[model samples]
Target: MVKRDGLKWWFTVAMVAACWRKGVAAEAQASAIWVMGDSLIDSGNNNFLNSWAKADYYPYGIDYYRGPSGRFTNARTFSDILGDWLEVAAPPPFSSPTTAGRRILGGVNYASAAGGILDETGQHYGARYSLNQQVVNFETTLGQLRAMMSPANVTQLLTNSIIIVGFGSNDYINNYLMPNLYASSRNYNPEAFANLLLNHYARQLQALYSLGLRKFFLAGVGPLGCIPNQLATGQAATGNCVETVNQIIGSFNDGLRRLVGQFNDGSHPGAMFVYGNTYGVFRDILNTPARYGFTVKDRACCGIGRNRGQITCLPLATPCFNRDQFVFWDAFHPTQAANVVLAQRAYSGSTTDVYPINVQQLAQMRL
Candidate 1:
C-alpha cells in the first residue's frame, strides 16, 4: 500500500481493535457511558424544545436508525456509535418521558441543539439547554438514581462511568460569529472570548466532578470553518475554509487542552480527562476524503442554497440518496458515515487522535 493508504489502514486497525475490546470489557466492568454536549450529541431534546434548531423532520435522519429521531445528524451520531463500540447501550434523551425507570441506568443524554458553554450563547435558537441546565438536569437524574438504589450502588455506578462532553462549537458559530445577532465579537477578541469560554467550561466540569464524575471524555472544537454552513455563509466560502473561524476554534481548542491537563494533573484527584481530537479527525477526513471513503466533503447532503448549507434541511427537503458519500448531513453536523469513523477514533487511537489516553484506556483505569 502507498504511504497514505498505509496510514489509513493503520487507523482502520486501531478502530477495529478499539471496537473489539468492547466485548472484552463488557465482562470486566460495571460502568455506564453518559453523554453531554451540543447538537453533536443531542439525541432528541430539541424536538421538545421551542428551538428553531431542530432535526425532527424527514431527510434529517434519513440515515438514522429511527428515520428522524431528532438528532442533528442524518443518522447515528458520535454518541450512539461510541456507545455501541464501548458495549454500552444508548442513553435515553433526558427530555424523554421514558427516560425514567431503569433506562437511566445505562446513562442519559443531556445535550441540546445549539447548546453552549455560556448560558447567553445560542439564545437566538430559543430554549437551548445550556451546560449548566444540563448539569442541573443531571442532578435530578442523580436524585432519581438515589431513590432507585442504594447510595453505594449509585456512587459506584457514577464514579466508574465515563461522561463524554462535546461543546464549544456553537459558542463561536451561534453566538460570536452569528452575523448581527450577537455583539460578542465586537466586545471580545478571539483570545478574550476563548478565555471566557474556557473559564466557564472549567466551572461546569468542576461541577460535574463535585457530583461524582471521575472519568470525562472531552471533545475539542473541530475545524468549524470548513463546515458547509461556514463555507456558504462566511467570506472565505469560495473553495476555501474560513481562516478566521478556524483560528477562533484553534484558540478555544488550545485552552481546552490546557484545561484538560489541569484537571488531570491536580484540579481533580483521581480524575481522568481524555481529550477527544474531533478537530484533527475531521481535518484528516477533509484533507483526504477519498482515503476515508468520502466523496462530497464540502456540502450538506440535505439543505438549500450554497453547498446545500445556507439553511438546514427543511421539512421534506429532498435529501441526497447517497448519504454515505457526503461528510455532512446538514449545515453544522457530520453525516453518520463520518461519525462512525470518529467514534472509532475517539474510543482508541493514537495521541494524535485521542490524548492522554483514549476512551478504552480511560474506561479500564481503576482510578
Candidate 2:
C-alpha cells in the first residue's frame, strides 16, 4: 500500500490534471463568442462613438475589477458573464484601436448603446451602430481574419463559434415609443411594426449566415414596462408594471421566436438558432425577487427622480451601497447581480429561459 503522503501527492496531481482537462474541453467546445446587440451587451463600443447614450462614467463599473470600462452595467454585462462560464475571453469592442492583430482570433464585440434593428431607430441619439451596421462591422472583422488565416480556416472558425444577436428594445424604447421624435408609431401599429423589424432582422441574419455563421443566440427583448425608466413616467401604478407596454413588446418577441423556428427548419443548412426568452427570465425574477436575492426590484440603485429614473446616473453620482439588492443599476440596465442571473439562465437554463437548447449546448454543437 502507498504511504499517506504519497497518496496525498497523487490525489493533488490527479485533481490538477482533471481541472486542466476540463478547461481544455471548455475552450475547445466554442472557439469564440461574437456578441452583437444594444447597450445590454456592449462592452465599450459607445465610448468611441459620438453618442449621448454613453455609460463610460463613474459608478458604471464600480463592482467590476476593471473600473469604468464603458459597460452600462455596474460590472459585467450578460455577454461578459457568459464568456466567463465558457472559458472564453471577453471579446474587445471592434471600435477599440487595439482590436487588430492576434486579438481578432478570440472574437469581437460590435454592440453599441441605443443600437436597434432598424438603421434609423436611434438616429436622434447621434452616431450609434444599428444591427445592420454591426453586421457590416463583423464583415470587416471577417476580412481581418482572412488576412490572418486562410479563408477556409476562417470559415471553419466562425462555423464553430457562437454569435449573439440582441436587438428590438431600442427600436421600441427610443423609436416607436418616443412618438414625439420618431414617425414609426404613427406609420404602423404594433403588429405591423414588429413585422417590419423582423423583415429587416431576417435579412441581417441571412447576411451573417452567408458569412459562415452557424450557431446563433437570438435574445428576445425583456419586459421593458417594468424598467425604472417606465415606472418613473407614472404610466404604471405604484408597485405595478405597465401591462400595455409589456404586451406590445411581447408581440415583437413572439415574432422573433417564430423567426428562430423558421431559421432552424433547414432553411439555413448547419445553422442552429436558439431563442433566449429574456422576457420570461426577467419576469420570473420580477415576480419573485426574493428567489434572486433582490429586495429593491422597482427602483434603480442609481439615477434621480421618482423611481430614481427621471435621469440616468450622472457623472460621479453616489450609487447605492447595496447594489446587489437592487435589480436596476440605472434607469435602464440591470445591476451586475441581475446580469449574473440572466447570463446563468441563458448559458445553462431550460426551455423557459432559453428555448430548444441553452448556450452550453449550443457551444458543444459541432456545426
Cα lDDT tens digits, model 1, 1-367, are: 1233454476467557756776466352327878889999899988888998888888777766689898888878898878866667788899988899899988999999989999988998899899989999999999999999998998889988999999998899889887599888999999999999999999989999999989999999999899889889756745867877898778889888888888888868888898888999889888888876778988899888998889878998888987877889888899888887788788778898988888888888997
lDDT of 1 at 91: 89
Best-performing candidate as measured by TM-score = 2
Clash-forming residue pairs, model 1: none
Backbone clashes in model 2:
0
Give all candidates' CA lDDT scores.
0.85, 0.88
lDDT of 2: 0.88
Cα deviation at 50, candidate 2, in Å, is: 1.0
lDDT of 2 by residue, 290-330 (tens): 77678889889999998998999999999999887888999
